[model samples]
Target: MMNGNALHTLKALDPAGGSQVHASPTDRERLLANVLNTSRPAPGPAAGLLRRWRWPLAGVAVATSLAVAVSTYTLFGPNAQPAQAMTPPPLRYAPGSESPRAVLERLAVVALKDTSRVPAGSSLYLKHQGWALSTRIGQIQVTSAIVPSERETWKKADGSMRWKQRTLPPRFQNAHDEEVWSDAGAVGEDPQFTEDATGPVNANDPLNRPAPEEPRAMGKWLLASQEYAGTAEAFDSVAAHNLDELWNGRQRAAMLRFLATRTDVTYRGKVTDRAGRAGQAVSVDSAYGGLPTKYTLILDESNGKVLAYEEELTTTAGALNVKVPSVISYFCFLTARVD
Candidate 1:
């Protein structure tokens, strides 16, 4: 007769794998009696058998428990939650992703949605500040002077308009430069005021033309209005310089869309304007001049506002045998209050 303990162990392990070790209660009792009453094995042999099987039996029990626990968890475990789909992060601004033309096109779409109009009799006031490069008499070195100026204009439908300008004294670098500037009296600190006393009458002024609301028409008008529209940069400069004075809501959209059709407009990343305002930088370069020059415009992304317009004398510009980067002029539109 086999050991009764071994039979019970076999029954437990083979419960589902194969036939049962004890088919009935009577068979199990008979086997147990045979093991207890018949041959008592040597004590040393029994001890050796228990030692050999103890660790293996414990390992099997642990493995079975683990399998059962994993299946239970997969089916119905507490605190188990379904997996969630991951979301991607937002896209960052990359210059290579879109051209400046594309960027302006997108902004134009947003601008055209605004149905707000400039009220009748509204005045367009622009504050301009920049430095002008000047060489002092009897001096070889060049210096710059700050020039602060402003313009106010109320354009009427009939090309007649009222215009005013306030000029300020130019700031010089040193006493010698200041003396030269004073002696020359290049610009005076005077408040100039003027108005169109002539009432509404159609004149042949370019401002009198109907506003262009399409890209091709706007481009044609811009090019025809320029005295030297030889390059895209020159045209772009004209657009930037006259942006505030030229267009309103839908007209501005047309101008922007026109810019998109130009291939020379380049995206110049982002920068802070001279006024320390953050904006997207764009520029057009023209070698049409004797020297290379860059006309840069910074536009506020939030409101489609032109923050600043700059003209930089590139390193290619040589004067007095000196080639250096200099700002020829800049105009920053500080504020516009409705009248």
Candidate 2:
């Protein structure tokens, strides 16, 4: 299976394939207005008569409207404020604690340290299902920071000086150069490469390795999923950011609307220790592509921040001897400090 980041990269490269485009807000509003107007009945006899005499009764109508508005405000507005102003969820972890959110945050910080410099290379060893998948794989990590030609120096907390620099070999300057380097004897032509003494070696024969294909563009459907995952009405918004960028176009919008309008959501709460913070876990059931889906959200009871979330979806298969599993999982983690 393709890794999530790789899948995202492929999708970005192929905008015409499966990409989804969302309807604009104006379009959505127009559709809603059309539905409402079509369903509404024409004015009745009394209403028509009132409309004809509306000009003469304008002052009386205004006074009546003001009276009703004041009455409604006095009766309902004050209580509504308290409900509307309810406190938000708490942070997932206390700065000094060892919660799962803290652990993940630390991991993210470490990962970012290496990834912060664009065009820089690093080697990673990954294991799956208790088996070593790769001893070492070379990666060219990029960041939002623009690449700079000059080296920069910084002092470590311990007072040691460190320097950072990035330099690409003459033959590996551009995409074409990178492609050539990917196919050279050092890296071979394999989609998967293993680090050798000289660098990463592509396991597949150069002649057999195919060029990477462009990814399909995400469409309305995927964007809907993102929106569904992003709001307080559905899953925790903060926890859903990780999945938001992975989806695009209409799918995101539909997901958001679905999450906002759906009323079938049920929440069940439990207490658990995550990372190391005491947190409350809430479970929600929903649907995706008409299939049953579940979301598990863990929120810090004190700080109101979501610590983590997990989403699961059902799957099925047709023809072939394929064994389709009933569940797919997505996850996110968060952390923060408490005063």
Candidate 3:
């Protein structure tokens, strides 16, 4: 999605992981307003440690504000200090001789013949393990960090959906990043309560809508979908990024067909994803969120299901405090199926 909206939704990510800090509704509203209203620094040749990545963090705020019926916590308010910046290692891709179009076309063939289906009235289920660089440019201190988590979601055709995410110990690019996290007691020690969220979501949200199973139909869907969907790479990457939505084999095939048409993608040959599963890679480069980023998608070599989606810096971190050539985010699909 928007790289500026770093850490994806940050819906279930919190560096202030420990006990829940209970606060009155007024206090929570006040904190949310204060944090969201905080001025974010500009990127590229600009002055300041970047926190624009937290733009999506504001999106998350609206979610929790869905009538106080969602969730509430006074996490990393302006008064709180950010201890360290998260710098995760970049992905290592293996080379390939074939064209990305050839790889995608081949995968589409496989998806078309597959029989994976979700019963009409039942929900589609998907589970993934992912991590993203999270930086909260709070008033006190700038914090950049990563939190690993396993997330699972269920969505019905009617747009009813719910998701749960649990903290997983994170990995860092260097020892110092780890030290900063440890010193601040920011280990994954169960800081997320999004682990308990459920259905009755904002079904009208474009992302929660089920994508059609044909390229032409999906194109129309995208045209009417979010503004970002206007960009092929953005929409494709977002589909692979948010496993929260549903699509059967046919739909996945349609996605591949559409992707095959994008000339910007390059075939990266074969690679083992974070799940240690063999996969075929296709990548596209974007200066998303002002950081020159390489977005890679790995497909299961056997059936063409998405295995992982990753984003890392290609040249520099831009306005962010993280080092160049570091991974900004990654998600590995450990389980995905209609159940």
lDDT of each: 0.49, 0.30, 0.58
- Report the lDDT tens digits of candidate 2 across residue range 114-206: 322211122221111100001111221111111111122332222122323222122223575444333322221222322111222343533
After superposition, the stretches of candidate 1 with alpha carbons farther than 4 Å from their true spots are 1-97, 119-127, 130-144, 168-207, 227-246, 320-323, 336-338
Q: In model 1, where is the ten-residue run with the lowest total lDDT?
A: 82-91
User: Judged by lDDT, which candidate is best?
Assistant: 3
Model 2, residue 113: C-alpha shift (Å): 32
Q: Which ten residues in a row have the lowest lDDT in candidate 3?
A: 42-51
Model 2 TM-score, 2 decimals: 0.25
**lDDT, ranked from best to worst:** 3, 1, 2
Native-to-model Cα distance after best TM-score fit, residue 111 in candidate 1, in Å: 1.4
Candidate 2, superposed: residue stretches over 4 Å from native: 1-233, 236-238, 242-262, 273-276, 313-327, 330-339
**Over the stretch 131-187, how does candidate 1's per-residue lDDT look in tens digits?**
222211111112223444454555455534454444445555468655553443432
- In angstroms, give how far residue 108 of model 1 lies from its true place: 1.2
Q: Each model's TM-score, in the order given?
A: 0.55, 0.25, 0.67
